[model samples]
Target: MKVLMIDDNELDLLISRKLISKQVTSLEFTEFTDASQALFYLQELQENEFDIILLDLNMPDMNGWDFLDEYQKLDAHKANVYILTSSLDTRDKLRSREYEVVKGYFDKPLKSNYIAEIINSQQVY
Candidate 1:
């Protein structure tokens, strides 16, 4: 499976990669510390090039929400997006429901069970 992770924090990216790798053996990761850079990368890819997109809501320049706005305009394959955020606010979770491409919302420092679930969900597709 191919995964694109967009997060500003390097530590979080490393941790997420570790957690996800534990669940998926045949995994390919494309990580970005900048949301805009990720978006640009996505533009060049073909359909199904990425199987999943783990996005962080809190970012420096372009937040996850802004990324989603631009992502919606792209005439590219819309990979299933999972919001991996530290925000516990119900409002944020509720807001995520507005995005059709978003598949799930998970907390930071991703749990083992969540990684398993993500892997299983991807298999369904």
Candidate 2:
């Protein structure tokens, strides 16, 4: 599976990659520290080029919410997006539900069980 992970923090991205890689051995990752650049990449992606998108809500230049706004303008693709954020606020979780493409909301320092859950849930689609 191909996963596009957008996070401003390099450590978080590295940790997520390691954890997720351990769970999904056949995974391919495209990491981005900048949300706008990631959005630009997504704009040019072909259909099903990526299976999932793990997005961080707090970012510099463009936040996850801004990215979603632009992402919605693009033609639909098969990528299921999950908000992998550090925010513990219920309001943020509730806001994520407003987006149709968002499949799940997860906390930072992503756990192995969450990766397993993502894998299992993805297979059902």
Candidate 3:
């Protein structure tokens, strides 16, 4: 599986990569600590290049919402977007439903079982 992770925190990125490696041995991970850089990369990519996007909500320049807005414009089919953040706001969860690409929300310090479930459940197209 090819996964893209966008998080500003270096340590969090490190932990996530390690967790994913442990849970899903075959995963090919590409991580970005800057939302803008990630967005740019996504913008220039061909269709359906990424299986999933693990996006951080609270970023420095372009927050998760902004990234999602731009990402939605790409119009890629079956590309799952999961909110990977520490946010506990009810409104955030409610607002996430407004977007079709967003698969689900997962709290940061991500659990391996949850990651495994998502990876296993992915319907390859």
Candidate 4:
């Protein structure tokens, strides 16, 4: 599984990486602090380059909503995007459904059980 995690906070970014590493051992991991750079890479990369995208909702450079907006313009649509947010608002959850590529919405500090759930749900290997 090739996963790309985009978050602005350094602590959250590190914690996510650590949690993911503990849960999923055999996979490619890429971390992006800048949403625009991640979007650029996603657009330019080959089809199916990333299996999953764990995106943060509130970012300084570019918010997760904007990331999804730009992502829709790209041709690469294989990856399943899961919004990893700290926001508990119901509106955010409802709004995510508007995007075709978004597969799921998860709360921040993505748990090991959620990681397992993601693995089981995807079954992409």
Candidate 5:
């Protein structure tokens, strides 16, 4: 499976990669610290290049919301997108539902169990 993670924090990205590697093999991860760059790659790349997108809600230039907004403009197919954010506010959760592509939401300090849940739920082999 091909996964793309868009988070500004390098540490979070590294930790996520580590956790993912421990659970799944033959999974290719493409990470981007910049949401805009991630968006650009998605826009230009061939269709179905990524199986899942783990996105951060709060980012620098282009936040997750903004990225979703622009992402909607493109012809990207139904790539599973999960909001991985630190915000626990109800409003954030409520607002995330507006985007049809958002498959699930996860709190930051990502747990391996949560990753396993997503993987198991999706059965993305």
Candidate 6:
């Protein structure tokens, strides 16, 4: 499956990718440091191009909230989006509920098992 990861922090991005990779084989990962660029990338792609999108909440160019706002407006595929941020605040988790399409909120570093569940479940369905 294809996974699109959007995060400004290089280390966070690398760690996420590494963890995610361990869970699934043949994972097509597309990462972007800039959320705006990632948004544009999403706009350009066709529906069902990617199966999952792991987004970071705190970004310089465009925050995850703003990305979600703009993302809803664009004619894009309904990919399973998850908020993967470092923020441990419960408020951040609550705020994620505002987005209808968001699958779940996970505080990084994301575990291999968590990602494996998603990958395995998708295969089952």
Estimated TM-score for each candidate: 0.95, 0.95, 0.92, 0.92, 0.93, 0.89
What local distance difference test score does each model get? 0.91, 0.89, 0.85, 0.87, 0.88, 0.83
Q: In what order do the candidates fall by lDDT, top score first?
A: 1, 2, 5, 4, 3, 6
Clashing pairs in 4: none
Clashing pairs in 2: none
Q: Which stretches of candidate 2 lie over 4 Å from their true place?
A: none
The model with the greater lDDT, 1 or 5, is 1
Residue lDDT tens for model 4, 6-42:
9988798788888888877887889899999998887
- Candidate 1 lDDT over 1-125, as tens digits, reads 88999999999999999877876778999999999999888877775588899999999999999999999888877888999999978899999999999999999889998888888888898
Question: What digit string (tens of lDDT, one per residue) describes model 2 on residues 15-118?
Answer: 99998887789999999999999888877767548888999999988999999888888885648899999898899999999998899999877998889988
lDDT tens string, model 6, 1-125?
88889999989889888877776668999999999999888887776588888999999879999999988887766777888898878898988898877887887788876686667656763
Clashes of 4: 0
For candidate 3, the 10 contiguous residues with the lowest summed lDDT are 116-125
Q: Give the TM-score of candidate 5.
A: 0.93
Q: Global CA lDDT of candidate 4, please?
A: 0.87
Best by lDDT: 1
- Write candidate 5's Cα lDDT for 24-114 as tens digits: 8878999999999999888887785787889998999899999999988887575788889998788989898998888888998889888
Q: Which of candidates 4 and 5 reaches a greater lDDT?
A: 5
Deviation of model 1 at 91, angstroms: 0.5
- Alpha carbon lDDT of residue 96, candidate 6? 89
lDDT of 3 by residue, 18-113 (tens): 988887788888999998898888777776688888989999999999988888877555478888889989899888889998888888789987
